[model samples]
Target: MSTVLFWFRNDLRLHDQPALHAALTSGATHLLPVVCLPAPDERTPWCFARVGPHRRAFTAAALRGLQQQTTVLGNPLLICQAPPAAALPQLAQAVGATTVVCEDIAAPYEQAEIAALRAAGLQVRTVWHSSLLHPADMPWPASDLPGVFTSFRQKVERAGITPAAPLPAPAQLLPPLDVPAPVLQAVGAEQGAAAIQPPAPPQGSDARSSFPYGTPGCDGSEGAVLAHLAQYLARKLPHSYKDTRNGLTGLDYSSKLSPWLATGALSPRQIYADLKAFERNHGANDGTYWLWFELLWRDYFRLLHLQYGAGLYRARGLSELPLAQHNQRGFERWCQGETGEPLVDAAMRELAATGYLSNRLRQVVASYLIYDLRGDWRAGAAWFESQLVDYDVYSNQANWLYIAGRGTDPRGGRRFNPTKQAQDHDADGSYRRLWGTA
Candidate 1:
């Protein structure tokens, strides 16, 4: 009987999981669902823990949800600690599996993992289902994608390119092979066994939080995200999204879907699909259209990663100019929300406390770091990677590079005047009062 190893990376949820569906329909007599946990102490080049406590907690919750769902489907998830390159080949060998299938990731480090698996003589098959639209469905090749967001958006809109409907989760997965506990334990030991802990109970909602991921019924699980989405739409929140999205506080200010989207617990196409239904039922408005617009921006960043590869991670970024010198002290202050700028400090404190920041505040703090602090943009990006519960590689890097004048921005870098931003977005001082001393 044929056996296949289905490695789960960022795409954690079973619903709308094309890769998972493909693995089930591949006719393999036995299938194993596996999640490779990152080393708890993994540190980045900037000496910051690559995965902070908040993100770790959020990821654990998502995995637990996935485990429960997979168990219900009769194929329990196998949790492992080694990186994909180290763990996958050993597991496949132990189980005598012939094929390894997973979702294709676009980031540099993740691409390296796939390369390592192929090098180990494993027949790896990857499905590109992470984005709203598949790369093949684009009007142009990723290599030839427009450099600017506006140009890309215009071309895609002109071509009338719509995302393919998402695939439903499989009803019944092939039962797991009876690999012995000793063999599994040996493989795990060779790769290092990283313990999976249950996520801590949420800290309850802060009325000042735009994203209350910590609130009850709003934890990082796929079920929580889907329920939250339903509640938002049920209340017709999308109708006011465009106008309220810039607000400094309040849960209704934005969709707050980034956490789920980042973890792949919620698929972009799934979001797009629900959005279209809402527009059909409620009649489309600017708010609804803006949500689609934002999704397109997400797609654009993913495409950028596909186009640039390692270039996106470099100090010089995509531009020919060299970035400013790294200022460790300035960056440290920024990370601690101690930059002495009230607005930036508040935003930073909010991120440090809640692992989330509004889209407007993200830009505001990013601009402050790159322009006002005159710090290396990469340092700030790494800090975000360390702190944000919803950090996505493409969007985080692309945004920092854009703000640093090293990306596709035609006008070069963006520098937001903190005083002006305070006046415009937080005119009432309520947001500052909440996070000022934090």
Candidate 2:
């Protein structure tokens, strides 16, 4: 019997999983579903973990949910501790399979992984399902993507483009490819499960956390992803999203969907559909419109990657700016939230304590690091990649580049005056007090 390997990337959930759907229909009689965890010891150029505790713990929770779902569908999900390039080809060989199917990620590292797999002689099929609007569905070609976000959004709206409805979860997947137990144990196998069961939920979480992940209702599982969305909509929060979105603290301040989106536990298309239905039932307003606006921003960033590729990762990004100097000490202090700037410090402390930060504060802290602290934007981006539970490659890289005036921002760059930002957003300083930076 022929077998195929299904590699899980950022798109983790079975719902609306086009890549998973593709694997099921690949004509293989048997299938092996696998996920490769980032190496724990891997460090970024800044010498910090490439994936930090919150990201690891949160992603592990997502795997546990995925493993459970796959098992219920008659296939067990294998978690590999090894990198994809090393582990996948070996598993494919062991299972007597040559084709591997997965979600297509546009970022440099993810694309490099795919390149490595092809070099290893395994046929890889990558399905693009992460974006809300299909790239092909856009009015403009990828190469001619509007440099500015507003232009992109205007074109999309004028073209009346809507995302394809999310695909339903398959009732079952192909039978598991028979691999010897030794082969399974050789790989990380369920986030290195031979050594431990799925990662235990993180402990000693801060009570003041807006996301409060690793606790009940916030672990990065598909079930929790859906549950959070159901509750957020059921409580009728979309109607007020715009008004509360800028809030600096608490879960109700925003949709809090990015974490699951980052993990692939949540689907942006499904979110879009549900929100549209919500507006129909409850009536459309600026708040409801803003949610869609934000979704467009997410898609815009992904498309930007499609156009720029590795250019976005450069020191100066897409612009012709000179190379930036890395302020090692300043960057370190900013990471620790001890830069003597009350608002920026509070935001950074909250980020460290909770693996999450408000979108408002994210911009503020990023600006403080780039414009005020005179730090290398890449290092700050790296720290966020290591820290955020919802860290996304396209968004993180694009946002950092934009703020540093290194990308397509018409305004050279955004420099949020820390004092002014504090007065505007934290007028009473409650947010700062909550994180004890006051």
Report every candidate's CA lDDT: 0.85, 0.89
Q: What's the lDDT for residue 172 in model 2?
A: 89
User: Each prediction's TM-score against the native?
Assistant: 0.96, 0.98
The digit string of per-residue lDDT tens for model 2 on 2-95 reads 9999999998899999998999998889999988888889999999999988788788788888889999998988888999998999899898
By lDDT, the best candidate is 2
Steric clash count of candidate 2 = 3
Please give the TM-score that candidate 1 achieves against the real structure: 0.96
**In candidate 1, which residue ranges exceed 4 Å CA deviation?**
187-195, 199-208
After aligning candidate 1 to the native by TM-score, how far in Å is the CA of 285 from where it should be? 0.6
